[model samples]
Target: MATNVKVIAGDPSQGRTKSSPFEHPYALIPTPSLPTDGSKPHGALLNAVEMFLVHNILIRAINSILYHAPLVKLHDDIKDFLHFCEVFVDFTNLHHDSEEEHIFPEWARACGQPDIMNENVAEHTTFHAGLQELRNYAKQTRDDTTRHSSEEVIRIIDSFAPALTTHLRNEIPTVLQMQQYPNGDEQRKIFAKGVEKGAAQADNTTQIPFALGCHDAGFEGGKHRFPSLPWFVIMGVVWWYGGTHKATWRFCLAICIVGQRRRSFEIVVSEHTRR
Candidate 1:
């Protein structure tokens, strides 16, 4: 698991050639976020945040299948799972990106500690890289027109799941703390950004990357596929990522933006119920 990383001591961007320690077994990133005094997270936000990550990577895993399905080399069942990615991952990515860009800054500014922005940005960058690597690997296989086994997909999953999961475990707690926020300002920013982003999310410019459109045509542009298995699994995954898991993503948006609070209602229901 990734330690609670308040600050990273080492430099990655420096040097003639840029590289990450993710490939190395012994690369150590520090967790200055840990206090000298013992304390524990009540996990008010931790559980939901973790589910958000689960949905994200799992859907991307499915999207990898969708992106490669048309090619002769890919397996059919895997391709079937991609529809989940098409509908879920792109939506959530936009949501998370909006959060990072709009929500986090507001929290940092409100809490009067804008310094945490750098760490969150770095973590976001790392997550995108892991995503690109998986997509690239799948794309190369698609081009080969060579048959792929479940084993190959699992290999890709194995490579990505650890890093992505570690990121979820570590980075989540850092942001969810009450100390990092000032009232509900950050939540307000999230809704404003979500409405703005969500409105445009249906456009070709938004979903084309994960699904079919001008940019992805040769690789995966065609009629939309609807598989209930994928959609249902993806809904669960969505709950895992930024879906129904987070009280804030659901309730705060409702509370801060919609001004809906029945008994100071924080999400009336969460993934716990789904489980």
Candidate 2:
């Protein structure tokens, strides 16, 4: 299947002194467009809204690592970089877990088709080992510090990124297919409830802030407010929680605060070196 992928380019005005070699003009996975027509199936549209918002964050996080990995100094910068990778792994796992545990089962039951989500579950197996390897590498490197290798990090991601991204992109259309089921309004409610439950189960202290850090609010002309939280939560709560690992969060392509404007994609090595 043809997939639309576009590389995220860093704006020169965002504080970078020179163009990053990893900033390809057009090679990253593009977020699937949500439907606007009122006549469209509401269930599919709602599913698209939820899936696209989270999927875009996942795509950006992956691209951020790909764009910045080569710039990291293995010995001096590996600590924070590995933490960032670990956060990525955690967030990705949480999303898939939510789907498998909450969203997929609910949707299948609602549709009266136990196998509706089987393909997605199978796709998870394709990248599960690679993701686990990444998590293990990050933890091991943090303990030893000497085993860190930027190339090895990138190599692990490369092994699974294609399959991982393909699953991310394809699942959008599969969810959209829920439009064909009867009782559209009821299905939408079911989806919303599943989404809410899944979100409530997350470890807000880490996963929430990690997701905020991954999101670029200015994406696609800045029309959406994702993971939409109250102003106080974003400014007061998320800001406080995100500070727990201040240095590690810096590798994120965007800030974790509300209105997450673009920041330079370069990972700072000097700060870690100083410590």
Candidate 3:
């Protein structure tokens, strides 16, 4: 895989045109003012923040392809960008699936709010369809050597941009609102468990690397805490499984060691660059 990346680095296009979406600038959700000490029912907040981060990354990737369509001539660049798309889709799908199977159901049962997460659940269909379309387009682009224009991919993304953005933006506040449940104590416990279970369910190989690649540890003065994972697995198991792909995630930093009664986990992250 590493060798293939460099082999196709040479491709030429002398006079192609550059074009990007000109309508309006896209805005990402501001990272919420979440508590640092874990006093709050912040499982939802952490999960929502992860979603927001991935959403922003995916949108930016799409925009980058379209924005530099003219300048990007190498097959390797296109392939790498498309690989990023696959990772994005995989992460999004894994997250939503985990929520539907574990997180949402637990939240509903614990909070006695059966319909609280229904809207977010329903919104998945709208974006999932678009995601599938974009994924399919990316696959096609990957397979076809003659293919150059990203206009179709751009159009497909634009077709669902409104609904996708709405779902991404709206769901954060909805999850954040779960902190206000009447049975607050039980709800916090449930959310924490749900987050842990959801993380465990994800494919350790792609899931861990993709997440580490996208997450910015420096954000908010390096004080922001991300959901923690086990030290043994991250350092031992994950490192072995990741293999060649590990180089792509050199940005990861082992920030902290989370010790609980039942288990202990280390936080893998990126270096915090003080701005």
Candidate 4:
């Protein structure tokens, strides 16, 4: 409704108008209540990105452990998983701060009139509260290396990753449209401004590394076009451990390579060579 932008959240019929009758979802975890005085903050995408990163890293770490399994050797990888978790949690808290400080305020200003966006900000605030609850529980389990990451914490993270993923997927289209303008010059001006702002703030920083770690490589059955990372990191990850580790390495490699259309030409060449 702001120019050509669409707002899709909340209940859908209380005198629905360009002013907005589309109710926004409770959308976001329970978090600290946000102020409604209309100060444009930051974050939103970063929060979603953090969720994506955590999801990928945690799930991959869990799965990687299974690859080294028979229990005994899993001990070492499990230690790695815990260390990773510590770092992952630290990243998430910082990301959340960006949301509370900057991103939500922007949403509030961007959607001030219908204030659906403002309400969305409120929802984001609640999300922080939920995270705080998680933090308390997590702190209690700090020295513990087991899966004591509360079912609530795990459940929220598990649910949030997919939900946040969906939100980001949906929001990106909106961000593009919001940046577009009446003409090329106008569009470029707006984008230039956005780029300037982004350079200073750069919320996506932690996300890029976390996302790359989670997505680009795997043992078996996943998308392969994600790009190979540095060889040393790959070798260190795949080889330093042992045979079971090698299986996981080969498994990831096989899916990446063999999944490539299963070339009929390879079979043909092999048969010709045999003859």
Ordered list by TM-score, greatest first: 2, 3, 1, 4
TM-score per candidate, chains pooled: 0.43, 0.82, 0.67, 0.37
Whose lDDT is higher: candidate 1's or candidate 2's? 2
Candidate 1 vs candidate 4: the TM-score winner is 1
lDDT of 4 by residue, 123-201 (tens): 3343444445444544554455364533444554554444333442343333333322223343333333443453345
Q: lDDT of each prediction vs. the true structure?
A: 0.37, 0.69, 0.55, 0.33
Candidate 1 C-alpha RMSD relative to the actual structure: 18.3
What lDDT score goes with residue 33 in model 3?
68
How should the candidates be ordered by lDDT, best one leading? 2, 3, 1, 4
Candidate with better TM-score, 3 vs 4: 3
Instruction: Give the alpha carbon lDDT tens digit for every residue of 83-132 in model 1.
Output: 32233335446645765765567656666778755665565565565455
Taking all chains together, the TM-score of candidate 3 against the true structure is: 0.67
Tell me the alpha-carbon RMSD of every candidate.
Answer: 18.3, 7.0, 10.7, 17.6
Backbone steric clashes in candidate 2, count: 3
Residue 252 shift from truth in candidate 3, angstroms: 12
Runs of candidate 4 with Cα error greater than 4 angstroms are 1-83, 86-120, 146-153, 158-163, 183-212, 215-275
Over the stretch 90-133, how does candidate 3's per-residue lDDT look in tens digits? 77777778778877887888777789989889998897888887
Q: What local lDDT score does residue 155 receive in model 3, on the 0 to 100 scale?
A: 78
Per-residue CA lDDT of model 2 for 28-104, tens digit only, reads 34555656684564676666766777876677677767766776665535677788888889889878987888778
Whose TM-score is greatest here?
A: 2
